[model samples]
Target chain A: TAGITQAPTSQILAAGRSMTLRCTQDMRHNAMYWYRQDLGLGLRLIHYSNTAGTTGKGEVPDGYSVSRANTDDFPLTLASAVPSQTSVYFCASSVLLAGEQFFGPGTRLTVL
Target chain B: SQQGEEDPQALSIQEGENATMNCSYKTSINNLQWYRQNSGRGLVHLILIRSNEREKHSGRLRVTLDTSKKSSSLLITASRAADTASYFCATDQYSGGGADGLTFGKGTHLIIQP
Candidate 1:
C-alpha cells in the first residue's frame, strides 16, 4: 500500500515563481501535515490539516499555504517562491492527532 | 524555534555496538516520537511513547521517557551499517483543543561502521 506519496520528486524554480507540492495518502488518515527539513534546523511544520476542508498554520507558514480539499490530498503551495524556500519538503499523515505519522518520500525544491 | 534538542549532534560506532541518543524538550507534551531518515530522504517513524509511559521497546530500539525531567532517550542495540542515519525526536505538545503538529529536534547523526 502506498501509505503516502509526493509528486515532483525534485524541482528547480526561479524566485518569484509559484509552485505546488503534491501529497497524497492512501491510509485514510485523519490528520495531514507539511514540513520542511533544513540542515541543522530539523523539521519545521509549514501547515497542517485536521481533516478534510480544514487547515491550520504551523511554525513556518509565512511562505507556504496548504489546502485540504479532500481526505486523501494535502497540497502545499508557494505562491511566490524565494531562495529561502529551498528545502526538502515532506508530507505526513496520521490516524489520529497524537498518533505516529507516516511520511512520504519528500520533494526537493530549489529556488534560484 | 524547536521544542526538543537532541544531544551529541553526531555519533560514530562500530557494528554490533550499542548507540544511545538523548532528547530534551521544554514544554509539556501528549507524546514523543522517534524517527529515522537516510541521507536526502524522508523520515520514517520508529516509535512513540506517551506522557505517562516510562519506556517502550521495538525490536532493537528501546525508548525511555522521563516526563519529570522532560527528556527522552533512544537506544539502538547491536547497531548495523544500515542503522546509519539521522535520528530525530518529535514532541506532540499538549493542547486543550484542536489538532496539534509535532515539534522536532535538531537530530543526531549516527554512523554505524561495519
Candidate 2:
C-alpha cells in the first residue's frame, strides 16, 4: 500500500535556496511528523500534525514550516536553507497518536 | 535534546547468538517502541511496550520496559545476518504537550556475523 513515500530521495541545494520535502501516507493515519537525523544527535522532531488541519512545532522547528492541507499529504518547506539544515529527513505517521509509526524511505538533504 | 539514549552505539555478534540493546529516557513516556533500520532504508517497527506493561514479544524480538528505571531493553535471540541493522528506541511522552512527537535515540548498530 506504499505505507509512506517521500519525494527527492536526495537533494543538494545551495544555501539560501528554498525547497519542499513532500510526505504522503496511504494508511490514513491521524498523525504525521517530520524529523531530521544528524550524526550522533539522533532524530529530532521538526514539526507535527495531529490531523489534517492542525499542526504544531516540535523540538527543532526553526527555519522550517509544514502544511497539512489534506489527510494524505504533509509537506515541509525550507523557506531559506542553511548548512546546518543538512541531514536525513524522515516522515512518519501513525493511526493512533501514541501507536507505532510507519516511516518513509527518507530524504537526504545537503545544504551548502 | 533527545529524550532517549541508547547504549553501546555499535555491537557485533556471530549469527545464532543473542543481541541486546538498551534505551534510557529522561522523561516519563506513554509508550516505547523499538524499530530497525536496514542500510539505506526506512525504519521498520519491531515492537511497542506501553508504560504499564513490563514486557512484550513478537517473533524473535523480546522487549522489556522498566518504567521505574525509565529504561527499556530489546533482545533479539538467535540473531541472523539479516538482523544486521541499526536499532532505535522511540518514546511517546506522558505530558499533554500538544502534538508531542516521538523522541528517538541515536540507535545501536547491531551486526550479526556469519
Candidate 3:
C-alpha cells in the first residue's frame, strides 16, 4: 500500500496566489487530517475530515479549506496564500478514530 | 488552547545517555501518544499510553502518565545518534471531543551527540 501521499513536495508561491495540496491514502482510513508545522511552534491542525463528504475546522483553519469528496483523497486549498502560511504541510490518515495516525512525507510550501 | 506542552525545548546528550521529554496538557485525555519526526521527514508513532494505565514500555522506550497531573513523559534509554530527532507528545482528550484527533505539543528537540 502507498500509505498516505502528498503532492508538490515543495513549492514557492507568491502572496495572494491560490494552490491546492493533494493528499491520498490507500489505507481506506475513515479519517484524514491536514496539519502545518512551523519552527518551534509544533504542528497545528488546519482541517480534518471524519469521513468522506464532511469536513471540520481545526485549530488554524482560517486560510485553508478542505473537502472530502471520496474516501481516497482529501485536498487542502489555500485561497489566498500569505507569507505567514509558509510552512510544512502534512497529511495523515488513521483507520480507527483513536488509533495511531500515519503521515505523508509532507509538502514544504514557501509563500513569498 | 488544548494543545499539549513539552518541557526542555531542546536537549543535547552523549550516546548511551538516557533522554527524557515531558508533556503536559490542560484537559482530560483518554490516551497519550508519543511521536518522533526525523529532520525533513514525517512523524513516526513511538508508543501510546492509555489514561487508566500509569506506565508502558516498548524496547528501550518507556512512557509514564499521571492523569491527575495531566502530564506524561517519554524516556529513551541508551540513546544513539539515530535517535536524534524531535519528539512530540499528543493527547486524545477524555471528552471524546467528537473527532478523535490528537492535539500535539511544541515538541522537544533531542540530539544524541556521538
Candidate 4:
C-alpha cells in the first residue's frame, strides 16, 4: 500500500537555497507530521496537521513550513536552508487520536 | 527537548541473552509506543501500551508500564543480531487532539552480538 513515501530520498543543497520535502500516505489518515532527527538528539516535531487544510507549529518550526492540502499529502518546505538544517527528516501518519503512527523512509538533507 | 528519557544510552548483549531498556516520562499520556530504527533508516513501530494497560507483549518483546512511577521498560528475550537497532519510546498525550504526535526519547542503541 506504500503506507508512507517521501521524495528526494537525499539532497545536497547550498546555503540559502529552498527545497520541499514531500510526504504522502495512502492509508487515508487524518493526522500527518514532520520531524527532524539530529545526532545525539531525538526526533523533534517541526510541524503537524490534524487534517487536510490545517497545520500547526511544533517544537522546531522556525526554519520550516508545512501544508496539508489533502488527505494523502503533507509537504515540508525549507526556505533559505542553513547548515543547522542538515538532518534526516521523517514524515508520519496516524488514524485516530493517540493511535499507532507509521513513518516514511526519511529524507536526508545536507546543507553546505 | 525530549519528553521521554531512555536510560543506559546503549547496550550490548550476546545472542540468547535478554536485553532490557527503560523509559521515563514527565506527564500523563493516552498511550506510549516503542519504535526500532536500524542504522540509516526510518523507525519501525514495535508496540504500544495504553495508559490503562500495565503490560503488553509482542512475540519475543515484552513491555511494562508503571504509571504511578511514570516509567516503562522494554524487554527482548533471546536476542539475535537482527534485533540490533536503536530503540525509542514515544508518548502520545491526550491534550492537543492527539495531534501533538509523539514526543520521543533519545533512544537506546542495542547491539545483539552473534
lDDT of 1 by residue, A7-112 (tens): 9999999999999999999999999999999888999988988899999888899989899999999999999999999999999999987589999999999999
Per-residue lDDT over A38-82 for candidate 3, one digit per residue giving the tens place of the 0 to 100 score: 997899888988889988888899999999999999999999999
Instruction: Summarize candidate 3's per-residue lDDT along B31-113 as a digit string, tens digits.
Output: 88999999999999999998899999999999999999988999999999999999999886433357548888999999999
Best by DockQ: 1
Candidate 4 residue pairs in clash (backbone atoms < 3 Å): none
> In model 2, what lDDT does residue A46 have?
92
> What RMSD, rounded to one decimal, does every model reach?
1.0, 1.1, 1.3, 1.2
lDDT of 2 by residue, B15-66 (tens): 9999999999988788899999998888889998988999999999999999
Q: For candidate 1, lDDT tens digit of each residue in B35-109?
A: 999998889999999999999999999999999999999999999999999999999865557557798999999
Better of 1 and 2 by DockQ: 1
What would the TM-score be for candidate 2 when compared with the true structure?
0.97
Q: Could you give candidate 2's per-residue lDDT for residues A1-112 as a string of tens digits?
A: 7889999999999999999999999999999999998887878889988889999888899999999999999999999999999999999999876588999999999999
**Candidate 4 residues A1-112, lDDT tens each?**
7899999999999999999999999999999999999989989988988889998887899999999889999999998999999999999998864578899999999999
| B1-114 per-residue lDDT for model 4 (tens digits) | 678999879999999999999999999888899999999899999999999999999999999999999999999999999999999999975454444778899999999989
